[model samples]
Target: MSNYKFILSGGGTGGHIYPAISIANELKSRFPEAQFLFVGAKDRMEMEKVPEAGYEIKGLWISGIQRRLSLKNFVFPFKLIDSFLKAGKIVKQFKPTMVIGTGGYASAPLVKVASAKGVKCVIQEQNSYPGIANKFLAGKAEKIFVAYDGLERFFPKNKIIKTGNPVRQDILNVSANVEEALEYFQLNKNKKVLLVLGGSLGARAINKLIEKELNFFAENNIQVIWQCGKLYYEEYKKYENKNIKVLAFLNKMNLAYTAADVIISRAGAGTVSELCIVGKPVIFIPSPNVAEDHQTKNAKALSGRNAAVLVKEVSLDSRFEKEFKSIITSETRQKELSKNIKKLALPHATKHIVDEIEKILKTL
Candidate 1:
């Protein structure tokens, strides 16, 4: 097989960054001689994360338009034009045979430039509701990899493929025993474990809600594995008691997933994919501050299928306790949620997406 050059672009959040990394890793394993380049927004998390994943990356001077009126909105047009010109230069110099985008502001320019150059481009849409960047690129993309059904509304039907989202390889083969995981986290094996996740940067609403309910969890004999995330760890670390283990981040998410009987989490695309694979009963608290209110749409997709419970951030104060109590108190409900959610797990998503990419390249 001949060596191929490829460019991958995505950023802004771990949701976009991790999927891009996962896809790159899969491609590297399949094509050992492949040369890879990652393009991302300058100063974004992807600039830091892509290199850490052992890939060379270039950053574009780009950012998303803010929802509310701000000074950033006024400069959006100039940034977009500059990013497009820069992206065109990178694509011309790199001469990549194909470009793949997971979805972010950085991806918009790179994929657009690649497509204009007559290079094959593929985009992966991780959510049920597509982001503006992906939706815009979909028309010119050779293939559109999606995690959910009914995306024909956003992309051309002929170009759409239901390949799911690429998740961390470590999570795909989670084999930790429940008892071993409980012991590893230094928690009681007898008490039910409630794992709380609010993404890597953390959710202010979820963190505050968990703080108020710490005593209730203790009284109910529930052991807590709270990942307060990096941003909120300092503010909430004082709540760490015998029943609660607070962490800024959990590197060994497989252990945490194995240890948990139930989960309280935000409904980011990557998290939702991992949770489906973990097969635990979960109460989703979707972050409201995201673009297109996509997190709420993601949570509703699973909840609509009777796979998980959806609790809006605004309703956390009144609905959290009642919703959580119902699941924790009933084994039948827990089992039902677990079984239904497991049905949604596309364990071979990374491989399937790569297969589509290869098919598209062959046609090209």
Candidate 2:
């Protein structure tokens, strides 16, 4: 059992990939002799990121179907068939004791093939609304780890386990790093800090909203740490100054969380989970472009509980400043938000997930 081999399949975005890495890392800490192999889509970030985390990864020629009809859509069936064959080969060769899918189209083929061949499958879903891949794989999954309630609508009631999303280890200790985090960001202690995140690739709508509000922020005496994303960096970098720190991406996310007094962010499930741990006052502007508007759902799950504020992208022009001003100007409001969000933090989520993984490992 100590020498068990595990296959983890998920990718497409940081939300999916990072959770897989976190789970694998926790499993490794517990069972040093365990073997792990990551399976991701070819040409995706996971191919680069997983290896950087000291794990071996294989890439399948797979991509999600494009909503609009195109040449890629026409070849979708071929890609699906190719992925199935390659995934079956990998499962046959690896002979993993268990396969875990963290929800991406790339994960479906591998998880499907492995389960069919009698390998146990586990699904970790990050969103309040499960993705097509996880939904399709639900019946076959032995256990479905989820962050939100009400997922029984999509998954089997008996199979669901309400373990929150696994967050970066750094996030669990962010409070201890505040002084160093402020120095790392080179910010003034006297001024309020507003941290803005548009996710890893960046969100066009968020960047535009930030750009339009630069003057407003300065007038309100708030300094900014804006992670505008790589795609939008060039356009937004010109706005950076002594008061405005614009980063294409944040390598030290824990530090960013530590330094901020208030946060404005996209509500990707992974980001929301980390934010809850950060426990700062937050204004969540979910990306409207994602699948099933799940980002909005992720945000509402918190805002509904009064843990964070949710503002739809469509209403940013009308409500952004009002929402931002309310949180920034009111100390009591900030404390209440921070306190409430912290109440929702599952600091031991990684351990809880691995505990479940251990239970399954025993069964195997």
Candidate 3:
């Protein structure tokens, strides 16, 4: 049994947390006896999610700087210093062979301390535009795993590896289960299905868009599987009926992907990676609230290649139905989008990243 010790830090949103978990799982599969520890921001989603994934996690008192002036800004410096001291202690106690950061507020201090202590560090940048935390950590990282090309603009050219973003393994084989997926979601196989995703917490604009288009979906004989997200479920649950299935969150995304003839979603880096692997015709309404407006950049990458369609939030009220109808009504468009998106899938990203970690470990 190999006795490698690892410290993984990332979490604030599911985008960061899931990739950290996926990487940890890939590492555990290869080294069954390996020890893993996850570091994340206190009171954040990762504190709950990491333990649920069957790993121990430590929470750091860290948060991102608010874009606007607020009381939190004054507390930021103290939190940073406290987190750094705590991260240093954790590194000394854990004595990890390597540290991996997937990018979140907590990741900054942990990876910084680990690198300062002369530990190997690897960072995964999930977006075309790197976040502030990852951009700062890039110099100290031994290798930087990126999901997009042209990231040499942010990190050193020699350190960047185009490994792609890690996605849930269950989503990889969705194509083979179409019939099962239709039955699981209790939808008819004869009608076209549109799956709408807004991520785990949910997107308010997407939810409102669906609300506006409900009658249009019914009139056109289309079925909808809408994952409205946890925060909006109570408000939108009344819309659940024969033709519309409203879920707070989808635990079986494989089934949802298989049932979808077309997907309408926010263009998160992880979502983009999964959609490419699922090979579905997609209409991207990128969330405008994200850092550096990365979601728009992600959607544009595919739309520019004719792999997906993009609809900006500002034009949604005037153009959603027209843009959505264009895809759903055309069989040739669906096939073309699916074929092109599938060409972009990097199914072995987790395995390849682990291989890089192994290479670094071998040198030790």
Q: Would you estimate the TM-scores of all the predictions? A: 0.98, 0.96, 0.97
Q: Write the per-residue lDDT of candidate 3 for residues 202-278, one digit (tens) a residue.
A: 99999999999999999888999999999999999999987799999999898898899999999999999999999
| Full-model lDDT for every candidate | 0.92, 0.91, 0.93
Query: Ten residues in a row with the worst lDDT in model 3?
Result: 169-178
Candidate number with greatest lDDT: 3
Q: What is the number of residue pairs that collide in model 2?
A: 0
Worst 10 residues of 1 by lDDT: 355-364
Off by over 4 Å in 2: 175-179
The residue pairs in collision within model 1 are none
Instruction: Name the candidate that leads on TM-score.
Output: 1
Error of 3 at 16 (Å): 1.1
- Give the alpha carbon lDDT tens digit for every residue of 1-364 in model 1: 5498999999988888998898888888999999999999999999899899999999999998887899999999999999999999999999999999999999999999999989999999999999999998998898899999888988899999897778888898999998889889999878999999977878888889888998898888899999998999998899888789999999999999999999999999999999999899999999888899999999999999999999998898889989999999999999999999999999899999999888877876
Candidate 3: which stretches are off by over 4 Å? none
Task: Provide the lDDT at 134 for model 1.
Answer: 96
For candidate 2, the per-residue lDDT at 225 reads: 98
